[model samples]
Target chain A: MREAYHEQLNQLADHLAGMCGMVADAMELATKALLDADLAIAEQVISDDAKVDEARSVCEEQAYALLALQAPVATDLRTVLAAIHAAESLERMGDLALHVAKAARRRHPQPVLPEPVKPYFAEMGRVALKLAHQAEQVIHTKDIDQARALEDADDEMDDLHRHLFTVIMDKDWPHGVASAVDVTLLGRFYERFADHAVSVAKRVVFVVTGRMPGSGDEEL
Target chain B: MREAYHEQLNQLADHLAGMCGMVADAMELATKALLDADLAIAEQVISDDAKVDEARSVCEEQAYALLALQAPVATDLRTVLAAIHAAESLERMGDLALHVAKAARRRHPQPVLPEPVKPYFAEMGRVALKLAHQAEQVIHTKDIDQARALEDADDEMDDLHRHLFTVIMDKDWPHGVASAVDVTLLGRFYERFADHAVSVAKRVVFVVTGRMPGSGDEEL
Candidate 1:
């Protein structure tokens, strides 16, 4: 029974890693769709979200079943719990990617981004994809140092997010209110996507060190 | 042991309902701060969020303990799991309210909403607070009917959100990019708060009916 529980735990981790990969692909495709104005890729990313949702449900069910049957305690319990949360964070990352796709689709035929803010989004997209890949690695390795590094990557995303505002707030911004709203929401989507990745990394940190990363509190 | 488990479940429900009230209050104050430019109210809402976080952690710990020690199955398992999810949704709602407050604080003496968009935000705030109260009611009663009704309330919020965009997109829109960006994020914050409330309601629907609300699929 103990061996079976360990096997199930490993399976949960594997499932989480798979989810991370799916999200990374979704974000990459969504970013391309946003930049290139490719409706086909945008639609694909939007539709592919259902698969990520399915993956999350599968991971959640396995965790619940493990709890009901084996009732593993201590670090085992934390691992299962962390798996549930990490899956959720990954699922949300997929949803953020979907939002990006939908935005891309909404402004189809016409490019959503104006010229001045284009470079900022391009960099944001690059940072987002990099973070997504790192998020996957954090899940697979459960390395505390890598998990901390993910937070730094997320900080870069936040800086890029702030830079977007500076451009919009400048006197020369000629895109007007509609484009500003689009840019604001787009920057937010990428920033939030990175936030969820950091959250997944924090869960990994919790599993390995028995401490919540951001709060640095041992009790949680 | 069965009765003890049942008692803990009831306590968890009670705790979740309490969180709902706190979140409702937080949203109200945050909205007031945004509309009135009241820094003190914004600060209060921001500070009160810590209490909400503490409440969520307590609820989660209790749910985890129940899963580990009691190993509830079937409907009982679903209820505990739903409580965990509902608590998370509620906690996120609190965070959204905090974001609203932070935005309000950042703008300080100046009102975030311009004259033309003020009414839309006012209406959004009203709908948000109303939905938060309804969310609390649904948790306390677990009325599947009311749970479904909350979705309609959420639909109203979506409408209000769309209206903000229409106002911004209009040729007559006088606000510059800065205000437009602020309005976009503010609208999104309210929309997401309602979305989380609707998610909590759906979880209640799941617990009562053994079916997920949106998809009607038992697989989740």
Candidate 2:
């Protein structure tokens, strides 16, 4: 029974990693759509959201089943719990990507971004993709160092978000109210996407260490 | 051993209920501060956030210990997991109240809100406080009906948020940039506060039902 439970647990991890991979692809494609003004890709990201949603549901079910059938203890219990939390975070990340795609579709005929802002969005996308990949690694191998690195990466995204806001508030940008709202919402999406990635990393930390990061040290 | 675990689990539930009660108080005080522009009360809300944070850490620790030591299965596992998630949602609710209070403090000495918007702020606050109370009840008793009511109440908050935005956008309001930003952030805070309450209710539903809300009978 213990061996079977272990197999089931491994299967849950596999499903979570798969979901993370899809979310990463969605983030990459969504940003590409935003930067290139590709309507088809944007539409694809929007349409593909249902798959992410489905994956989230499946991951939750598998994790719950393991808890129910196996009655996971200690580290095993933490692993199952973390899988559920990570899946939820990944789903939200996918939703944020879809939001970016929707914004891209709305601004299709002309690019809303000023040239100076392009690099920020590109860098934000790069960091987000990297975080998602790192999250997948955490799920597969439970790599504590990789999870810690993802947390550090989130700070860079925050800096980039601040830069985007500074540019928006600059006097030289002739963009009107519509552009201002678009950029503000876009920055919010990137920030929130990074936030969710950080949340996944925190879950990883909890799974391995049995305590949330940044709280006083307590032995597992 | 099972009896001992049950005792610890019950104690954890009690601590969670205590936290919920404190959070409800904070929300009420924060709302009053916002509606009345009472700086002292706003300051109190900000100061009380540390208590909320401390309570959250304690509850998280207790819940993790229960999971690790008890190795609860089936319904027992669901209960502990739901508690952890509910604690998080409640902690975020406290943070949202602090945010509203901080905004109120920044706009002190003079009212940030115009007289016309006072009624909406009052209504929003009332609903937020009521939802927080309902979430507390749900936590204490595992009451599904009250939880469902809280879910329904979220719609009203959403309506008020939309109304607030409409008022801000109206040309008759003579809105300055600072006021617009203030109102927008306030509206978002109320919306998100209600969202956290809804999340708490969803967790209650999951705890009782052993499946996620909106699963639609889908297989894993």
Candidate 3:
């Protein structure tokens, strides 16, 4: 029974990593949908968000059961709690991806990105996917260094986000108001997605080291 | 020991409600800062956000202890878990309020909202505070009815959010792209704040009813 309990605890991390993988795929597809104006792919990303939400429920229910039934000790208890936080962050990442897809769907035939900013968004999508996968690995291995690396990658994404904002706020911006609003929200979506991925990796670091990265106990 | 555990569980709810009250005040002060472009008030809201983060740590550590040492059963287990969720939501609401305050500070002495949309933001702020206070009450009482009422109030917030967008997107908008971007993000910050409030209330309903308070299981 004790052996099975430890295995279940390991499985909780596995579930969180799996959910991160799902959101990564969702964001990748959603980014494609946004740049290409592919409504079908956009809809798929939106619908698949449910799977990510379900995955969170899986992690959470497992977490609650572990805490209630097994009475895990300090480190193990912290692991389960961290799983809860990681799962919620992954779930939110999925929502951010869905928001990206919705932006694509909202514009339908007209591409959301106004040509010049297209490559930036494409890069943002790639960075977001890479960060999510890195986060998954961090959760799996409990690698504090890899988790710390996620923050550096997130900084790169933030740079890209600021780049997009510059394009939007440029005095000579040609896209006008509606397109500007779309880009603003889409930039925020991608930026927030990366932030959550970093946050997920930080949770792993906290589980292993009991210290939140950055200046203090709280993370970005 | 069990009796003390039960008392701690009750205290958990009290702490969450207190945190909600803090965020509510933060948002109220933040709204003032935004409209009046009050740098001092904005800075205060930004700094006070740490207290809400500390409150979440308090709730989370208490929860982990209750789960590990006390081993609460089913409903008690769910309540503890829900408290964890509620605390996180309240912390996020505090962040959203900070976002608003920062927007104000970013354009110090210059109001974030234009004359026409100022009332919309003012109303959004009012609704956000109301929803948060209602959420605090629901958390304390675990009253499903009060929790349900939060959704209706959130609908009002949503309408105000949409109204802000309409103002931003108007063809004759004189605020320029920078101001439009600011309004878009600020509108989202306020809308998201209210959503978290309703989400907090929903957690209370979930603890009481074992349902997620939406069509299937997702709250939002």
Which candidate comes out best when scored by lDDT? Answer: 3
For residue B202, what is the lDDT in candidate 3?
A: 81
Clashes of each: 0, 0, 0
Candidate 1 lDDT at B23 equals 91
**Candidate 1 Cα errors over 4 Å, as ranges:** A215-220, B215-220
True contacts kept of each: 0.74, 0.19, 0.72
lDDT per residue for candidate 1 within A116-206, as digits (tens), equals 7888888888888888888889888888899889877887888888878898888788877888888888888899888888888888888
What TM-score, computed on C-alpha atoms, does each candidate reach?
Answer: 0.96, 0.85, 0.97
Give candidate 2 misplaced runs (Cα > 4 Å): A36-38, A105-119, A170-174, A215-220, B1-7, B32-40, B105-118, B170-179, B215-220
Off by over 4 Å in 3: A215-220, B215-220
Cα deviation of A197, candidate 1, in Å: 0.4
Which residue pairs clash within candidate 1? none
Ranking 1 against 2 by DockQ, winner: 1
Q: Isolated chain A: TM-score per model?
A: 0.95, 0.94, 0.96
- DockQ of every candidate: 0.55, 0.28, 0.65
Q: Predict model 1's lDDT versus the native.
A: 0.86
What TM-score does candidate 1 get on C-alpha atoms?
0.96
So what's the TM-score on candidate 3? 0.97
Residue-wise lDDT of candidate 1 within B1-220, one digit each (tens)? 9999999998999999999899989998999999999999999998998999899999989998998888788889889888988888898899999999999999999988898887887888888888888888988898988988877878888888888889888877887778888888888989999988888888898889988867421110
Candidate 3, residues B29-140, lDDT tens digits: the string is: 9999999999999999999988999999899999988987888878888898889888988998999998999889999987878889889988999999999999989987
Best of the two (2, 3) by DockQ: 3
